[model samples]
Target: MAVITHDSAVRRQLRSGLICAVVSATSFGLSGPLARGLMNAGWSSASVVAVRVLVAAAVLVPIAAAQLRGDWNLLRRNASLITAYGLVAVSGTQLAYFNAVAHMEVGVALLIEYTAPIAVVGWLWLRHSQRPTVTTVVGAALGITGLILVIDLRSGLTTSWVGIAWALAAMIGAAAYFVLSAHGDGSLPGTVLAAGGLLTGGLVLLAAGAIGIVPLHATTNPVVFQDFTIAWWPPVLVLGTVTAALAYVSGIAATRLLGSRLASFTALLEVLAALTFAWTLLGEAPRPIQLLGGALILIGVIVVRRGELATPDAPDRA
Candidate 1:
C-alpha cells in the first residue's frame, strides 16, 4: 500500500510538471513574436526586455515575498544564484533573442537558440567529466545539419551574421538557465528564484541603460500585429504578464518537480510553439526546408534526451 501510494504521488507530480512545462513553453514562445512587433515599431531590444522583466518583477515579487514568509536567510544563501540567473538567464537571453528577431525571422532565430541542448552535452563532458555517448554525437550532427538547412544557404540571400551571433549567445544563456534552475541542494523556492531573478535582471538592465551601456531607445508608435496596428502597451503588457512572469515562474516550478534534464527535454516544445506563433502572429510562414530542419532539431533533441537518461548529471526527478 505504501509503494502504491508512492507511485500515485509520483505520477501526480509528473502530470503537474508536464502541465507547467507546456504552459511555460507556450508562453515563452510568444515572447519573440511580441517583442518583434515592438522592435518593428522602433523599440530597442534592450528596452523591450527591460520593460518585460521590470513589469514581470512588479507582479511576481510580492508573491515571492509571501512565499518567503520573512525567511531572509534563504535569500542570503541563494543571492549569488539568483543574481546570476537574473543577469544571464533572464536579461541576457531575452535581450539577445530580441536582437536576433530584429535581424532575422522569429522562427529562424528561435530554432538557432534551441540548439542549446547540444551545447549542454559538450559542457557536461568538459566540466563534469560526463562523457557523451555515440547517440549524443549523432544527435549533435543531425542538429548541425538541421541548422544549416534552417540557415537556408541555398537561398542566396545575405544572412544576418549579427543575428546568428546573437542567437548563439541566447543559446548559451539558455544552457546556463538549464544548469542553474535545478532544485538540488535545497535551492531557493521556485517562486522566489523566478521573482528575484526578474527583479535583479530588471535593475541590471535599467542600470546598464542609464549608463549608456545598452540602448533604451523606444517609440510610442503603434505596433503592427497580423493585419492591424494596435497600441504598443498591449503586447508589451502581454510580454510581461504572460511571457516573463507566468513563463518563468511555471518553468522553474516545472524544473523543481521534473528535474532539469526532463524539464529541458520538455522545453523542446518551445521551438514548435515559437514557429506556430510566428506563423500566426506575424505571418512569418516557415519554408518547407525550414520545417524539415525543425523536425530534425526536434529529433535531435529527443536523442539528447535519450542520452540524458543514462548520464550522471541528470538528477532523478524528485
Candidate 2:
C-alpha cells in the first residue's frame, strides 16, 4: 500500500510536469506566426515586442499582485534574481527572437535561438567542471542537426551580412534567457517573476524607443493605419494573454519542477510545434526535409528524456 501510494504521487507529479511543459511549448509555438502576422501588417519587430511585453505585464500584474501580497518580503530578497529573470530571460528571449526574425527567416532565427539548450549544457559543464554524459552530447548534437535541416537554412542565405550579425546577437540573448530563467529557488512565484521581467523589459525597450535607440517609426507610417481593423485586436489579445503571460508563468513552473537544463532541452520541441502551427494557421507549408528533421528532433528529445534515468541523482545542470 505504501509503495503504491508513493508510486502514484510520483506519477502525478510527472503528469503535471509534462502538462506544464506541453502547455508552455504550445503557447510559445503560437508566437512565431502571430508575430509574423503583426510584422506583415507593418509593425516593426521592436514595436511588436515592446507592446506585447508591456501589455502582457499589465494583465499579469494584477494576478501576480494578488498572489504575492503575503509573500511581499520574499520579493525583496530575490529582487536581483527576479530582475535578471525579467530583463534577461523573459524580455531577452522575446526581443532577441523578434530582432532575429526581422533580419532572417523566422525558421532560421528560431534554429539559432533554440540552440540555447546546447548553451545551457555548456554553461553547466563549465560552471561546475562536470563532463557531459554521452546522452547529453548525443541529444544536443541531434537536436541541433535536426533543427538546421528542418529550418533549411542553406537556401535562405543572402549577402545581407548585417542581418546575419543581428540574428547572431539574438542567439546570444536567447541563450542568456534560458540560463537565467532556470534558476529555481522557491522565492517569488512564477507569475510574479514573469510580471516583473515584462515590466523591466518593457521599460528598457520604451526607454530605447524614447531615445531613438530602438526605432519606433511605425507610429508615423501611413501604411500601418490604412489597413487597421478590429479583426487584429482579438488575436493580439490572445497572443498577449494566453501565449505570452500564461506561457511564461507555466514555463517557469515547469522549470521549477523539472529543473532548467532538462526543461530547456525539452522546450526545443517548441520549434517543431511552431513549424506545424505556421503551416496550418498561416499556410506556410513545410518541405519534406523539414518533416523528416522534425521526426529526428522528436527522437532525440526522447533519447535525452530516457537518459535522465541514468543520472537519477544528478543536480539540475542548468
Candidate 3:
C-alpha cells in the first residue's frame, strides 16, 4: 500500500509539473504579441524588458518573502546563483535576443535561440560526462528540424554575423537558465529565486538604460491590437504579471520537477504557442508547413519525455 501511494504521488507530481510547464510556455508565448503592441506604441525593447522585470519583481517579492518566513540567510548564501540567474538567464537572454532581432528577422533570431536545448544537451555531455541516450539525440534532431520548419528560415538568410553571434549568446543564456534552475537542492524556494532574479535583472536593465548602453524609449500611448486600441497599462500589466512573473516561477518549478534535459525540450512548445498567438491575436496566420512543424515538435517532446522517464536514475557517466 505504501509503495502504491508513493507511485501515485510521483505520478501526481509529474502531472502537475507537466501542467505548469505547459502554462509557462503558453504565457511566455504571449510576450511577443504583447510586446509588439507596446513597440507599436513607441516603447523600445529595453524599456519593455525593464518594466516587465521590475513589475514582475514587485509582484513576486512579497510572495517570496512570505514563503521565506524571514529566513534571509538562504538569499545571502545563494547570492551568486541568484545573480547569475538574473543577469544571464533573464537579462542577458532578453538583451541578446532583442539585439539579434534588431539585426535579423525575428524568426531567424528565435530559431537560433530555441536551439538552446541542443546546447544544454551538449553541455551536459561535455561538463557532466553524461552521454545522451540515442533517444535523446534523435528527439533533439527532430526538434531542431521542426523548429527550422516552423520558423521558415529560408527567407531570412540575410542575417549578419553580428546577429548570429547575439542569437548564439541568447541560446547560451537559455541553456544556463535550465541548468541553473535544475541544480537547486531545494534549499531555496523557487519563488524566492525567481523573485530575486527578477529584481536583480530589472536593476541591470535600468542601469544599462541609464548608462546609454541600450535605448530606453517609452511612451504612455495606448497599444493597438488588431482593430482596437487599448490602454497602454493593459499590455504592460499582462506582460509583467502573466508572462514574466508567472512564466518564470512556473518554469523554475517545472525544471525542478522534470530535470534540465526534459524541461528544456518541453519548452519548445513555446514556439508553437507563439505561432498560435500570432495567428489569433495579430492576424498573422500560420502556414500549413508550420502546423506540420508543430506536430513534429510535439512528437519530439514526447520522445524526450519517454527517454527521460526510462532512465530516471541514469547517472552522469555511463
Candidate 4:
C-alpha cells in the first residue's frame, strides 16, 4: 500500500465532500418529480414515502454502522435529537412533499418546501439571538414572494386546501431537519445521523401504515397502479438509492463543508433543478408566472449568499 501524504488526504477529503454536497442536492431535487410520477401511476404518498425510507434505511445502515463503530455512545446521548431529526426532518419532508404533489404540481410543492432556509434563519434569530443582516431579511422576503408567485397562492387557496396544507407541512418538516441537524455536534458524522434518522422515520411510517394512519395498502397494492403510472422498478430503485440515501448523505456533507447557511442557501438550487426535470421528463411547460418566480428565487439565493458571506456568525450554525 502506498503511504498517503497530508495534502493528498486533504484534497481527497475536499473532493469527496464536494461530491457529497452535489449528490445530496441532486437526490433531493429529483424526489418531488419522482413522487409525482409514482403517484400519477396510482401510488399513494404514504406508500411511496414508506418504501423510500425503508429502502434508504437498508442502504444507509451498514454505512452508518461503520461510522458509528466506536461512536455508539454518541447515538444514545443524542437519541432524542436524532429521532426527531429523522421523523420530522426526513419523514415529514418526504410525506408532506408527496402529499403536496398529489394535489398541486411538483414545482408548486417545491417552491413552498424551499422556503425552509428562511424559516431556519428566523429560528436562529428568535431562539439563539442571531441577528439578521439587511441582505438576509431581503432574501427571506424575496423567497416568500417568489414562492407565492410561483404557486399562485391566492388562486391555489380557492382551488385546493389539502394541497396547500401538505406543502406547508413539508416546509415545517424541512425546517426541522435544518435546525436539528445544525444543532448536533460535528462529532457525529451526518451519514450516521441520516442512517439512524431514516431508520426511525421508516419505522414510524410503517407503524402508521399498519394502524391505518395512512392508507398504504391503497398505494402499495397493484390495484393502484395504472397505464400511466406503472410500478417500475428502475424508478423505485433510483428513488431509494440515489434520491433518499445519497441525497441525505451529500446534504450533510455540504452542511459540514460549506456551513449550514451556505449549504442551505445553495440547496435552493433544487427548486430550479426540479422544474427543469419536470419540464424535460413530463413535458410540463411552465407558465409565465413560474418563469418570474424561478427568476426571483434565483435572485433571492444570490442575496442570501451575499449576506451569509458577510455575517460570520451565520456560517457558524453550531
lDDT of each: 0.79, 0.72, 0.87, 0.72
Please provide TM-scores, in order, for all candidate models, with all chains considered together.
0.81, 0.86, 0.94, 0.80
In model 1, residue pairs whose N, Cα or C atoms come closer than 3 Å (at least 3 residues apart or on different chains), thus clashing, are none
True-structure Cα RMSD, model 2: 3.7
Encode model 3's per-residue lDDT on 1-318: one tens digit a residue. Answer: 998997788678778888889999999999989988999899998999999989999999999999989889888998988999999999999889878988988888888899999888888778877667888888888888898889987743685999999999999999999988876668889989899999999999889889987889999998888767899998999999999999999999998887778889999999998989888778889998899899889999988877776664533210
**Comparing 1 and 4 on lDDT, the stronger one:** 1
Separate clash counts for every candidate: 0, 1, 0, 1
Error of 1 at 93 (Å): 3.4
Least accurate 10 contiguous residues by lDDT in model 4:
218-227
What's the residue-level lDDT of 83 in candidate 4? 85
Q: Which candidate wins on lDDT?
A: 3
- Residue pairs clashing in model 4 are 41-229
The count of backbone overlaps in candidate 1 is 0
lDDT, candidate 4, 1-318, per-residue tens: 244685466456546654665577767778767777777767777877778877888999998888888777888888987788878887777777777877987656767787777777767778767777899778767866766666655444334679989999999888777666666658887878888899999888888778876778434422222234445565677778988888887787766665555566667667666667677666676678877877887787678767765675443454
Q: What are the clashing pairs of model 2?
A: 86-197
For all predictions, the C-alpha RMSD in Å is: 3.9, 3.7, 2.2, 5.5
Candidate 2 regions exceeding 4 Å error are 1-12, 94-108, 156-168, 217-230
Candidate 1 global lDDT: 0.79
For residues 67-122, could you state the per-residue lDDT of candidate 1 as single tens digits?
88999999998898898899999878877886787787765776678777666666
lDDT value, residue 100 of candidate 3 = 91
